[model samples]
Target chain A: MSITVQGRQAATTAAPAPPGGRSRGPARVRWAAVAFVAPAWLYVAGFYLYPLASSIRMGFQDYTVSSFYTGVAPYVGWDNYSKVLHDGHFGETVLNTVLFTAGSLAFQFAIGLALAVFFSRRFPLGGPLRSLLLVPWLLPLVVSGTAWRWILDTDSGVLNHVLLNVHLIAHPVPWLASTHDSLTAVTLVNIWVGIPFNMVILYGGLQSIPGELYEAASLDGAGGWQRFRHITLPLLRPVTAVVLTLGLIYTVKVFDVIMILTQGGPAGSSQTLTTFAYNLSFQQLEFGRGAAVGNLLIGVAVVFAVVYLRATREQRQAGR
Target chain B: MSRLLRTSRLFRPAARPGALAALAAAGALTLAACGTGSGSGGSGGAPDTLTEIDYYDAAPQNTQLPQILDECGVRNGVKIKHQQVPRAQFMPKLLQQASARSLPDLALIDNPDLQQVAATGGLVSLSKAGLSTEGLYPSIAQAGQYQGQTYGIAPGVNGLALYYNTDFFTRAGLEPPTTWAELAADAKKLTQGPRYGVAFSAVGTEEGTFQFEPFFWTARGNLKELDSPQAVKALTLWKDLVGSGSASKSVVTWTQADVNDQFMAGNAAMMVNGPWQLPTLNADKKLHFGVVPIPVPSPDAKPVTPLGGEVWTVGHSKPAREAKAVAVVKCLLSQDESAKWSKDAGYIPSNQRAAAQLASADPQLAAFVQEVGTAKARTTELGTAYPKVSQALADAIQAVLAGGTSPGSALSQAQSAAKN
Candidate 1:
């Protein structure tokens, strides 16, 4: 945003002071701007726009393996969408995707906020401790996911071992091997992976609020909870909104973590829309239906963003 | 309209509607040009170096296969650039390359996937390239065919066998079991603290189905009749194994490699795996293992297993490059090389005579060699539809083993699922 302002200032200052400064100056500056932005524009067009357009177009065609080579895909209109929507596993998959995303976000945010509030107080080793919290975020998802897989293994896992020794349960839980627990197991891992991001963002938000508000509130007989309620929560709303919005987007399309841990398995109990789309496209070789599922996922993300934006807007208006 | 007029007047003084139309046409042409077409390379003239790709990213084969490719490249008078991708990513990578019309000059595709890749019309017919499947196992030869034309040919092949820890069997006063009843009884007896009696893959992938096929086929389960009684019985065997505490519940999550790791670590007394694990198992000098054909329902019943191997296919490219690729394939499939590859890579030779020689020379591989005689190709019955059916079957196994679904009902669901 600042770069754009700087660029505009430079362009204006240079526009009228050149040799052919009156008529051709603005056009030349505009052409120069276009030249500067061409690489980025071409990159967006080639990578993002082209693939998104292809995926959407593919959803309306009977694309298949042969279609890739022959470049011949007959139009099928709504057939792919209808077929995916009517699949026997579709309802279960949607439910799983919802539960996985909601469970991950709620816990991640709550725990992250608590930790951020705790870390707001200065103490010895606080800097190092806060930096250490970023380890999960720093590691590649695949590497951490694989490590989690071992830690969650049923009979041999350290988790079950510790749980058994602590007498938490009578039997070792089949974390990845049972259909009943696989979804919860994957969600727990995702929450663990996401908490670091939530914490770092919310922590930054917590730091930006003025200490004077808390000091004044305390001076006026406002207790800890009262001060936090009146000052902290209201002040952190915008940052909270950004954190949750990005969190929702990231969690909705999480593919690698679940893939590495479960592959949506133990009889598809953990299968989500992202993995389902992938399975349809690559595993089953039904590219059209896969693209349709992919489009539906995009619809889901868009719906979430719109509803969230509207709710936050209403909240801001009400705040005034 | 005003914005457009201002922009055009600022940019060009002589702009007109015709000129705008011409510019739009030029832009559309440029966009269309960006769309996929024949990919770069292998153009202008056929190069002397041919490209080859495979998923042999494991030890022994990973290191050994490149040497073989170099030898074949020398024999064919062309330099071969061999590339290997991980097993899971191999098919997706190949499909992507195919769509871009930039398939490698040669590809060693898994046997079951050959039909799917060939169906894309991205592979050169081996017959047209002057290659023959003569002397290869009939099942292997059939595996390479798509629409009655041979698109690939295998130098060597493999099939599942029961690898047992000899130390466990000896300590327990047990003999190698040849029938399902004895196998189950022995597995129960072998189960002890911190150890499973048996381990096999039941993961949600083709490897899971590949590991399950011996029991499935030995029970006379047909791929087209997935809900038949035979299929239910096969699934029930696996469920009973886990339920009886002879197999771990974790079998549903294990790949063949994981199962092998369990068996090598003494956590599993026996494993259902292929000959490709021999090198790794042998590397552990303390592990004393013996191989046998997967058990049958009765002593008289024959054990039928799926043939597992990779087949070399010449990819569609310039005529000269394809001819050179085919020559390399032919060299790789010659009788001497076939026997050598079978020995070095822990596979059974696809050629009957070469296999017979290998079996006698290496008594340890006799079980796999013998199984290959009766082994069937996964794609022979369903062709390109096999992968879908295989996935359905894998899901049924996981359902029965992990989801607690009855075998009959799970297979029934799988059958209906595969139909679409």
Candidate 2:
């Protein structure tokens, strides 16, 4: 009896069933679709949409414990956003955020692509080498930041010790003391943490491409560089887009690296938008202004997402 | 129908299972509550007490607190559960928890943040708890008092003091500085190599403000009277110290740990640090140091230090827990416990009698105790504005030390910033 019912259900539910054939009612179909999507819809509503709305609401008022019971947070529309925009360090923080994001993405992708290409070929200790490369990503952010800070310390860092012993420079450089050096140091650490992700993603992309396509190119007398540029690069476009978009979004929200390394200092030289927002809210207790800054971050991420989606859609159409 | 069933396979069973389990749990909890409420209410039984105390401490767990708590709890017959949070995150976390009406029963609050808590009705008034504020060091107690009511109580005291390396002084053939001019001159003489004569945590935040306060007080300047000629002189002394290369530019960003590291490495001859660093210094065999009251720029001026410390207070709404909270606080703040805590933690005692009792045992603590009497608690109103005010001061100091701006101009900018 169960086998006969299962066969009838399968025949009725098959796509493009013969016209007027035995079929489940549309109401049943709609209910099934709702049942399938309800879990994800609930999850997004509970976590993402709820918090986003709360943050937006909080951005308009001086929402604090002191003001909560009194219900006296005067609505100063756009004032918080205006104040943050006009702050003296606003320009510098924006610039730092852009530079950090662009720099990390560029270096991480380049280094990772090279590693992926190298690892795609069979080599001695290939498995172990790949595992070792994953160590930085395996460590927690705090541990990585702290280890980097120690290694980059001005007086006692191992980096300085090695360089000075090798007679690389006459003076010990303060890696975190100056604005430029601190940026470089933090970028180095970010690149270190970011490379493994890029490698794994790109390697998977590389493995998916057919060997026949490359063999055909080689038969046509294609050079190594030409094969990489014409074949590998073109094939990796989708992965590249994903990597760059994700990397940009992640780097723009950088906090722990800067916080643990320089704390947006020697003179607020390394302050990024996220750290600025953090300081404004927690340290200065200016929640409205912090939320304004955070909203700006969301706006940036949205813009990047739109651009990435457009690019990916264009690539897919061209492939078709 | 089969395709629809396959597509919704994961969700159909999950929804039903979750709903059933939640309903069952709720029914069980309701039944359990009914049973408990009907259970025996014995008058002879100990009170059902669960108190959560939030402790903002950076001290290592291996030291004083566990031992002190064990001894005190046995004596007082109370078991206190402490949740240790880092000092930097404590205030903000407490503020969030306060808004949710879930503040801990007791908290170790900083002096500056205490005003905000008091303003928000986050703390309970100690007088309401039957605790007397009499015979307390007025300045120390001033930290926890808001609107003429004591909302918190200082367990111990910390203040800025001049720490000089005896070896550096001997090598430079100079005595420990007694005045600002002497300090500068000594610093210049001792700064022969990579080593600096003096170091102060002029980094942004309370550290710079605390270090700068003595200079301002010594020159007969005050925070309220920023435009005073004395203030300029005091400001210039700091400018000259950094300007002349007697102090390292590192001071602009150095924390207490940085100052200690420099002193330990013998890179700095003198530092204006708090009592918190004393334990580390004393434990180090390579260094011989002496602690003295911070000197003023003017020889005739009385030396002044800035008083700082933590306070223990219960949440405002926890009346039922008040009896146990008071018992724990009283036990912890008793003269014996306070003295032991002061000695062990390298902080001055909040209780004057306890301070004297500890001083007789440790001469180093005596110097700290003597300084505490002269220490000035930051103005109550100004303390409330500390987060903003301190940041402004730190930025100004950083600017001056980094040679990007002059002290006079920096102070003017800082005053404007502080006003906002």
Candidate 3:
């Protein structure tokens, strides 16, 4: 390198060389790097970590709106947590959340997979069709929720209007008037919002698979279904795993759809943990109990994240 | 040598005091700008300057109150920024703002939420503000009082009334019943085709509680005494109305708008509605209607109507803001402004003199005024526990009506839940 004395080599070799032949120079560089990252570190510490710590602390207190204003929210040591666990609706909320998440994920993934397959083919209008399909996803959540609400209204909704006009039934459907229908309606709205995301991710995954693998399968006399089964499905397993995990995490925290569409109404049949936590905090002004519910949600999410990370790491190790 | 180099790098960009001073000055200016316009009265002593007041009125913005307020502002020196939040969001938003100590200078507080606000120490006491309750309607003014002090000012009054579609009534050959029993019987007679005999908003909120209050009071029962025999009887009548198919089970989730929609669509013969629906009913030419006091269970019993209205209040945390807020309140409650408000907003004036003046101008409003005398204040305790108690009542009512729970059992549960 000394004989060549090239700029690239000099620049590359300059990093390890130090004045006074001391390793402390590299240590100082490390310190400088930390200093550069300090602002971002402090931001996360203040905004995210501090609030999260405070929320956990508040969960143990007998916090209420009255107490918050009066500055007398005394710590009650597990009382708030106990009260939430003992509540009659807590179990129902958990069950509903799980059902909603599972139901939405299944339908969204299926429809999205179907759309991805349909669009993967070289068609004349594939580009335009794919773009057109994203309208529902492009809509703001509140707008989507409201539009669905109008479509699902028991009396004058478009769905009922169309059904009745076609003589499908003699009566108007109570789309949001019953527990079952309300749940169904909310799930449908969620599925609609989630499908485009699934489609986009799966389409990208589908495009990455080598054409040679499919060609080899075709040369071996593999049928369309066989080619998809052996080649596409096996290759997309990693993408599928990622999609399902991310979708599950997102769907479990579904609140806006429930809140706007049904508001956990028809006797709170559509209530999820997120809405329950919200109602507890904002509606009931029971911040301690709300925080307890929030902590439960965080705990569930952490467990999910851990399981996902473990599975992903194992898969990566196997791949290596 | 490395240490020396590192130390030089660290001190390379030394802090500039002049630049830091400028940054600090900018922050101070921003903070001062944010602080200056806050509170009831502006810090600078300029009485003639327009005081900006934020009012959260649930009245539809397109209707008369906003228009009248705008006109009044031009006539008077004061300026009001009326924000029409949806009815369901108004109280919660107010509560949130109050909690944050970022409440507007003036807010239209619902009567039922007054106690909750007062408990939070968010409202400025009217007595302390040198405002006398002498000119206001006693019962209406009493609605805003909590802990022996007035914290809000009622500009108008509202109560539950029997609104009958004249067309439906005529088609069914039924007259508006004067007693609860007659109303039930008449409702049965009116139940034909797609139209229901009676429509009541049994939704999970104050609407359900307020609508049911008349029935309970007429039966000589109180929400406080939910286990009483009369309470059971009142609950039984509501259940019977739903169970017998005279009233729709859909009312359990129906909002005021739902009831109004059904009534306007001619799907309901008679509905238990409030004064707020008057303007909507008046605007629809095809639907003829009449407003009468809510019927009682027995003819001997007095017709009891649950009182409803909004109250104007200033935030207590900001004393200077209260002065500006009081000015806005005075401007809103002025006789001429109050008359226009009552006329356009479909609310009965709290100013008795304003009511008297308007009563002669509109005969229908005068008839409404006669019913105001019998309007009973909602129980302050129930009003305080409104969020919890109302949901409990709605659930209990729905169970009795839909789930076949006995009224006696349903009422017992309601009482327990309300107390808890």
The alpha-carbon RMSD over the true interface for every model, in angstroms, is 4.9, 6.1, 6.7
Worst 10 residues of 3 chain B by lDDT: B46-55
Q: What would the per-residue lDDT of candidate 2 be over residues B1-420, giving only the tens digit for each residue?
A: 466556554445447556544544555455445533412122434324324444535553225776776676677665655566665677777776665555666677777678778887767788777777566788878888878888888778888888889987887678988888898899999896778898888766666777887777767766754546776787788879877979875666688778888988888898888887777788889899888778766667777777888787877443555566677777777778877787777888888877787778876666677888888877543767766777777666666665457677877877776776
Q: Is candidate 1 or candidate 3 better by DockQ?
A: 1
Per-model TM-score, in order, reads 0.91, 0.85, 0.84
Predicted candidate 3 versus true structure: per-residue lDDT over B1-420, tens digit per residue: 335334434422333344334444555455445544443354454233332233334445245666666665665565666666666666566655554455666677777767777787777888888887787777777788888888888778877778887777777677789887898899999887777898998765567778888887788876677778997888888888877878876776687778888888878888887766777678878778886777887777887666788787877544444665676677777777776666667888887777777767776575567667777777454657666766667667765654567888877877775665
Which candidate should be chosen as best, given DockQ against the real structure?
Answer: 1
- Candidate 3: the clashing residue pairs are B39-B321, B40-B320, B40-B321, B40-B322, B40-B324, B41-B320, B41-B321
DockQ of model 1 vs. true complex: 0.42
Which docking band does candidate 3 fall into?
Answer: acceptable
Identify the runs in model 2 with alpha carbons over 4 angstroms from their true place: A1-36, A68-72, A117-127, A165-168, A206-232, B1-62, B70-76, B192-195, B224-246, B381-383
- Candidate 1 lDDT score at position B190: 98
- Local distance difference test, each candidate: 0.87, 0.75, 0.74
Instruction: Give candidate 3's error at residue B383 in angstroms.
Output: 5.7
Q: Could you give candidate 1's fraction of true interface contacts?
A: 0.54
lDDT of 2 at B186: 92
* lDDT, candidate 3, A168-221, per-residue tens: 978776666665567778998899999999999999999999999988889999
Model 1 residue runs over 4 Å out of place are A1-22, A306-320, B1-46
Clashing pairs in 2: none
List the candidate numbers ranked by DockQ, top first.
Answer: 1, 2, 3
Candidate with better DockQ, 2 vs 3: 2
Which candidate number maximizes lDDT? 1
| Ten contiguous residues minimizing lDDT sum, candidate 1 chain B | B32-41
